[model samples]
Target: MAGGGIGGALGGLIGLACAVLPGPAPIAPVSSVDTSLWSAATLERGRQIAAAGDCAVCHTAPGGQTNAGGFALETPFGTVYSTNLTPDRETGIGTWSYEAFQRAMRKGIARDGSHLYPAFPYTAFAKMSESDMMALYAYLMSQPAVRNSPPRTKLPFPMNQRPLVAGWNWLFHDERAFVPDETRSAQWNRGKYLVDGAGHCGACHTPRNAIGAEKGGFAYLTGGSAEGWDAPSLVGSRAAPVPWTEDTLFDYLRTGFSAEHGVAAGPMGPVVAGLSTLPESDVRAISHYIASLSPRVDPAVSADAAAAHAVRASAAQTLDDEGGRRIFESACAVCHAESGGVGHFGVRPLMGLNTSVALATPDNLLHVLQHGIDRPATAELGYMPGFKDVFDDRQLAELASYIRARYAPGQPAWRDLESASARLRAHAH
Candidate 1:
């Protein structure tokens, strides 16, 4: 009787495992899709959607063909290579039918019925409208086919199991289409749809749980990290010394620079580039929606007063860290010094007002110091030369500490500067 009972229990466990293992059936491949069948308007809409989604940013590898996909995305689990989006018959998605594409987007399942990792941001894509999805499909199918097969993602141990993703999906994936709120204005709703769906801003800006699912509810869009840089909060908790108005946010998104804020750098450079393709109305709507999340409280000080305060603070700290001050004067003062007014580049952003200095951590500032801005958002903007070759870890730390003290006087001094600089330098190489 004991033997029979043990056997039955083991059999039941095996049955349960088998039940979850079977995924959806593989969709049949197509010989070729008729690109001519899609309307011009549909293709244009698809292009806009792709830009909003930042599809090319992930799919296209450095110095690789556009959409041919060999980009390596580093994640907590392992490195995942983005697959080719170009419609090549052998190596790309040329054989995929609309059903296959839709399933992959909405369900995180591939054409062969294998589960896709959440690194693709399909959770956000699932919220996209059916019309938009269709249009995206048409646009991708219409692209020039390139035969390039990206490296397959392989995780270690338990994570390597594909069926395990079913459980992950059950817990995290919503798989629901976007529903507009009736109480909100048309523009607000439109903005929400784009932000939540194609924009997937939360993917980078929101904190994630232990299992890698994005933390929602009160934790949504508070702050997160991407590619070693801080993705600051979009809400009231943002580190910007000055509150972001819709106008300022729009300027930042539209042109990648706001005089009150700072220039877009690091991972955000590509995001800003992608946003530049969007229409003025759409960009405004997104800015408006984001701005509404963080209502500006009156600072009660005039701009002139603030500027004077920063100057005084900066001057006072110069004595404390003479070495840092000297470095800044020789290396950074040409453009950043108030007395100079403007650098040779014709734009002068006040250090006190820059977001990087105001941030609680010195990560962003260090990154800028190391990498510099090779690609300014627009041609008119000034290019920043990296100090990686010129400054050692000790020097970088000193410079960052000095800048933070001078610009953001109210904030506590950052700790572990040398360690932080070392870590950033290691990552760069």
Candidate 2:
């Protein structure tokens, strides 16, 4: 009797383990929605959500049919091609049921039961509310379907196996939908939902672990690099030249440029463009939430820090080299040295107060020199041409070093500048 009881107990334990081992339930085809039945307001709402999510920026390729994806997204492991989100019968999600779309967004599973690579940012999307998810679905399905097949993603070795992604998801994914903080005000909660869920700001702003999953909690939004440009910290120890005020942050997010900071470029340009379409309240909410993340510094404290930084910069200027000085005087001074006036192409920025110059890292400066600023020309803003063609690696290094010495005195002189310049130049072309 004792032996039989032990055998049953062991069997029960094995059964329990088996039941809990599987991560998410196997996905099935969701019931299709009748597009005609979707309300016009719902469709419009979906359009706004999609814009906030910047879905089209990643999905649409340059000169390609909108939503017919072909853009190559570079990752540490390999390049991942964006998929065709358009509802084409053969090449796109035309056959995808609403269930299938939800599974992909919330569970990172493709319509065919294949696990999607995290490059699609499903990890962040997983936190979206069910209603918003459905609205996004409606909007995507309503778009005109284009029969364009983007190139297949070819990852090397073990990463090529779709089954491996299942393990990755199990390790990093949180299956719960976003829950609001009841203690917080409605506006704050709205901002959190927009940024943490659909906007997926942390996808770029937050650092990742070994598996490319976001490092949440205390490390969240403390700055991370993406596609060669550093997305500076949004919280503690803010990196923007001038400390961010709510209005300034809102303006920057809404217009893509701030008088205090600088214009958005690279990946940020598209984000700003998308945010421009969102409601003024939505943008203001984002600014409010971001500002709330870090403690506000006293004006005197900020002034002291600035003064110290300037003193260090002044001391370092004494060590500037003649070659770099000559280069700056010849090429950089016309715009940079003219006091109380706009920069080249009417850009309103001061290098001394610019974060790119004053920041500890030289990467942002390198990026600007290599690629330059090219925002859409408007009555208010102008463009600055890149200097990659004119400046060789050595000369560029000298110029960069000189600028750092003059504008950001206390920062250490950059080493391995030649190598950095070479890499930037190679990638530029």
- Name the 10 consecutive residues with the lowest summed lDDT in model 2: 1-10
Error of 1 at 395 (Å): 0.3
Clashes of each: 0, 1
Per lDDT, the best of the predicted structures is 1
TM-score of each: 0.91, 0.86
Q: On a 0 to 100 scale, what is the lDDT of residue 67 in model 2?
A: 83
After TM-score superposition, the amount by which residue 197's alpha carbon in candidate 2 deviates from its true location, in angstroms, is: 0.9
In order, candidate lDDTs are: 0.82, 0.76
lDDT of 1 by residue, 50-169 (tens): 999989999999889999998888877678889999999999999999999999999999999988889999999999999999999999999999989888888774567666677678
